[model samples]
Target chain A: MSNGASGAEAHSRTTAVALSDVNITFRLADSGSYTAVEGASLEVADGEFVAIVGPTGCGKSTLLNVTAGLFPPSQGRVDIFGANLAGLNRQSGYLFQSEALFPWKTALENVAIGLETAGTPQSEARARAQDWLTRVGLGHFGPRYPHMLSGGQRKRVGLAQVLIRDPKILLMDEPFGPLDAQTRQIMGNLLLDLWSADRKAVMFVTHDLEEAIALSDRVVIMSAGPAARIIGDWRVPLTRPRDTAEVKLDPEFHRLHRDIWQTLKAEVMKGYEQTGGG
Target chain B: MTRGRLLSLQFLIAVITLLAWHLATTVPIGGVTLLPPFFFSNPVDVAARIFKWFAEGTIWKHLWVTLIEAMLAFVIGSVAGVLIGFWFAQQPRVAAVFDPYVKAINALPRVVLAPIFTLWFGLGIWSKVALGVTLVFFIVFFNVYQGVKEVSPTVLANARMLGMNDRQLMRHVYWPSALSWMFSSLHTSVGFAVVGAVVGEYLGSAAGLGYIIQQAEGVFDVAGVFAGMFVLAAFVIAIDWLVTLTENRLLVWRPVAAETRTQA
Candidate 1:
């Protein structure tokens, strides 16, 4: 653990993303308002992996969007590396819940899009894209377009596109949420492997408890909402290079899971009530 | 060899049609000339008249004139259509504001504009070219507009996240997405180009196949009309082939319906 900490600190300055009393609201067409997220405050440490778990409409996605500088908070402030993110488009990588590959470009070209837009030479960008594709085990598939690829293959290409840039902070909104269980497990492990090598500050949004436990150093659980708020924050004590399967068998893992689930269960019931599910 | 087979098929159909016509005309089953010599003339006579036209330099000269008019109109119309369509697609509010006006113009009987174009541009090839451009432009424009509109939102978001500026997005994303639609429109527009050119010529022209056909009609020479039509059909087929070849080359990334199944 000390070695892992020292390594992360040595490679890059820990860039903290702090959200102070952030409130976000949306206006409905018919003279009413909806509060997606209200008074949500959280901080993600640099070189840390934080997972957000919540019921549907709890504004987990909205929180990530604010963090990415995609949407402005109606109230409060978001700071990245101690710099305010007010009307400023931060250079952060975002992986949507969907694979989101551009159907027109070949996998290699899609991956190189970031570098090309940043003014890198086409040939150099392509070579670097190829290198990243190989890292994600899609070297031979680079020439094929996204529509030609299977869902799993497309997801890997999407990851490669984001990974190649090595952005200061990564915000993923249910990146593996759509994959089949087996594929999801494989992708989860792949993400951990990638992160182990270069531990960038990552904010992952998911509803899956096991996924949250497997990937995050900390888990932030949100209450159900007309106005959602963070209900629990658990610091995961698992060591680095952790085997997802092995971690599940650990006694501490079960204890943490139980603790988090107990907090979430009431919120889940309240979510059902709000949606008229009762 | 394929050309040989095509010609043979055409010959066989021609022979069958000629036999039916000859029997109908000579048999005199009714008092009416059901297969009139002045209107539905004998196929053999039409073949001989076509040979005479070929000898008189009538075939090559008029065919060349019509072909040039059609090609020029198609090029001008398609280029203008693509540019305007892309521009309109980028500005949704402007597109919405003018959409009904554009549709109103499209719905207006374009054939009626033949005389107006002739009056505006004189009775030269320019009038025919103008008419042809109007006919082809709307077809291509509508297709390209719809194509650009239907670009996947997910893909656009992904491109934005990847740091693609508006120019790069337009070049890589919008163009490729709209290309197949543009090609489909081009195929249909080829036929429209010929219609516009021939109709404009028929309305007011001293030259072109349409002029020859009109003269033949005035003289009760049915075979000449058939020969002119045969030449027009050949031109349409040739242009269609060119469009197909270009489509195949430019759209190599697009998998054919059959290829998609195989990949699956």
Candidate 2:
């Protein structure tokens, strides 16, 4: 088991998040149990972008939730930075897949929500929100409501909401799942550029192999449920501040992609077999 | 401009109808009054009577009394309904337990409550206001309760994940979700508010348009009764218009229908 000091030093050197033997289960009304994730252990090094890829419903989101401290695991522990996550209020930043921007608030206000929640003065939060919005290339759209913005723009606002906090760890749950392929690629590159600058450890959850490979320093492939676990973890040797388009042309990228695909293919098939497929 | 045109169309229809009634009463086909003498009581006579009432009774006095009663009921009922509805919505167990009781109360003939209210509060404006409040409360309560209950789980989860405390969640998510429903019910409640006030006045009251109408009916004055009804209808329409204006201002985010857009 990775101890506290090792995790801290690792973060100082580029480790952002650490989880040990984390397990999550849901109890049923019929007195039965379903283990969503079982004994999943992993470390996200500081400045290291990691992706957790799995077949649908493999508890990738459950793992993310545990990491965020939104849900306590039925077993094991999760530590962010060098600190135990027992009573920490705002250790990590999260970007939900749906963008979940408040419909009543403008894009700027939505971005400022995190700072406001953390007790930052309204003016300071608004200013920081504006700065982050500009960074996301949405400066002009600050006043537009969520309903008025397109899917891509809403995701940008969601990203800005988290980025404004500048937490030690970033957890994103399929942030670009709803966007078109082109927009998804654009967002992927943008995320890489943003992360490359500060290099906060990011645990990005996605089903897309291409997305995982493009943005992550390490790809953690999770197995299928009734008990989804991290079956393989591969360190991608792709250079930092990488261009997604350029990375695709590298033969090494293709090799890693093929390996990850081969490992995930069986899990995907098993998932299909378990739940009658598409 | 469209509003002006619509008003003009209504005036044109009123004039034509009045003219037809006048001609039918005067023509006297086959020595029989084709239209009853009371039915064709010339628009001129009704207009003169309205003018007399306007001058003698002072339209503002009666208008003020009715307006005060309706407004009082509207405020009392709406506030109580929202408070009770929100409280009930927050506790699912309690809401479920009391749901049938609320429905039964709502289903009971609210008009029947007017006489009981009159008995309790007397023939004063308070009785009318109380009756009006009873009628309005249930409509607003049910809508607000349903609205709060129907808050999206996805939105609630998102708010929770964003670290919103319970009060903040209620303000940001639940309140806004239920606001539109509450406003829609308000539009309907306004008429009921007026109806309750009028009914209470009719059952027993010394003042108000309802009392005037009741008095007219006692004297076999059909024209006066119709005149009183016309005044009440105008009052109801005016209140409805105000409610609509408030709704439009509050619900600015709601998309305008294609027809309204084209009309604009």
* Candidate 1 true-interface contact recovery: 0.50
Q: How high is the lDDT of residue B140 in model 2?
A: 83
For all candidates listed, what's the TM-score of chain B alone?
A: 0.89, 0.91
Interface root-mean-square deviation for each candidate? 2.1, 2.7
Q: Tell me the spans in candidate 1 whose CA falls farther than 4 Å from its real position.
A: A1-15, A269-278, B1-37, B46-57, B255-264
Candidate 1, residue B211: the lDDT equals 82
Task: Write model 1 residue lDDT over B1-264, tens digit each, in one string.
Answer: 587898999999978987898776655666776776766877678778888988887688888888888988888988989988998998999899999999899999998898899999998899999999998999888888888998877677777777777898888789877777888667789888888888888888988878888878878778888888887788889889887777666655566632533543
Q: Candidate 2 on B103-162: residue-level lDDT in tens?
A: 888788877877888889988899999988988898888888888888766566666656
| Model 1 Cα lDDT, one tens digit per residue, A169-219 | 888999888889889888888898998897888899998988898888888
Error of 2 at A140 (Å): 2.1
Candidate 2 ranges beyond 4 A from true positions = A1-15, A29-32, A82-84, A87-89, B1-52, B55-57, B256-264
lDDT of 2 by residue, A107-226 (tens): 898888777877899999999899999999999999877767899988998888878878778889999999999899889888887886777878999999988988877789999997
For each predicted model, how many residue pairs clash, with residues at least 3 apart or on different chains? 0, 6
Q: What is the lDDT of residue B247 in candidate 2?
A: 72
RMSD each, Å: 4.2, 4.1
